[model samples]
Target: MSTEDIDVMVYDYTVAHGAIPAPLNFMGFPKSCCTSVNEEVCHGIPDKSVILKSGDIINVDVSTIYKGYYSDASRMFMIGKVDKKKQDLVAITKECLRIGIEAAKPWAFMGNIGAAIGNYAHKRGYSVVREFGGHGVGVEFHEEPFVCHVGKKNTGMLLVPGMIFTIEPMINMGKKDIYVDAANDWTALTIDGMPSAQWEHTVLITEKGAVSLTY
Candidate 1:
């Protein structure tokens, strides 16, 4: 299936389960899914007023509960013909996510995941958002083992089989500083007003490697 098909599936899953299946109620998110577009860093609630345009980039974040288990993942996509710079940023961001996932294994430190992502972003002259990072996911919505996007090796939690979580890397075109939309209480944007991109995957660490649950 295409990337668009996967996104639709995720959206449907979230909608079918409704807000009750999401743990955001405890955090006061007030939304079932997040569809953030250009200039909208994260937590962008989908709405009719927000229509995707041809050169726009969007990130769809979805989380759902199934059989008492919760799964979450996100993907970034280009609406149509976006500029080369933005396209490169999006491509590189996805690669960073891939590299992070590759480093997620049994006995691996959570910081290694962030180190891989951060190093790639920095080498490409981009900054990773340090405020919001990955976290453990499983029976509950969000759990232990906080994963920072920028950290030193062997600094944080250790990865082990049976551990499920997400590794989302938010790359900024300019500075790492971010701003939240107080009025809507959802949207997040870069303080410098530069474009940003992000990619995420709900992963489960197996005896061998990590499996993407929401793929």
Candidate 2:
């Protein structure tokens, strides 16, 4: 489906549940959902002119505010006929998110989450984007705790039960550097122009473990 089509779908789905799309009119954002394709790292501006094609990897980020609380999540899509290399990137990128979430147990340091994700990504010859990692969410669209995807272990804030946040690691097939589009300032592109994939889920720290709020 086209980006605009997906945006409308998101709007209708959210409204059906009496919730509003958080990204719509959020800080002047025009769309209800974000559709990032290929080298576009994040915050992609949806346009009807852009259509999905075979072998293309796309990330769709959705955020909604329901009843006074917020939830955010994203997933990567491998367009028809995706190659093995790209498929591996998507798989590993998802594993990175899982590792980070698993590291967010009670009494754990925030940096442990990043370290686990970064180490695994590096071992697989992928680089994690540092410009945008993750953030707390619930009362507001974005909050504290500032979850980083790459950092030294045992640093940052300690994870405590009841804290909610997102763990999205943007893995790049090339260098980790990125540049913002001068024309839009919102779309982020890889400096090396290689494919990037990301997965996100709003998580809540609990006594047992991290639970995904957007699941």
Using lDDT, give the best candidate's number.
Answer: 2
Counting clashing residue pairs in each candidate, in order, gives 0, 0
TM-score of each: 0.88, 0.98
Span of ten consecutive residues with least summed lDDT in model 2: 1-10
Q: In candidate 2, how many clashes are counted?
A: 0
Clashing pairs in 1: none
Candidate 2, overall lDDT? 0.93
What's the lDDT for candidate 1?
0.81
**C-alpha lDDT values of all predictions:** 0.81, 0.93
**Which 10-residue window in model 1 sums to the lowest lDDT?**
1-10
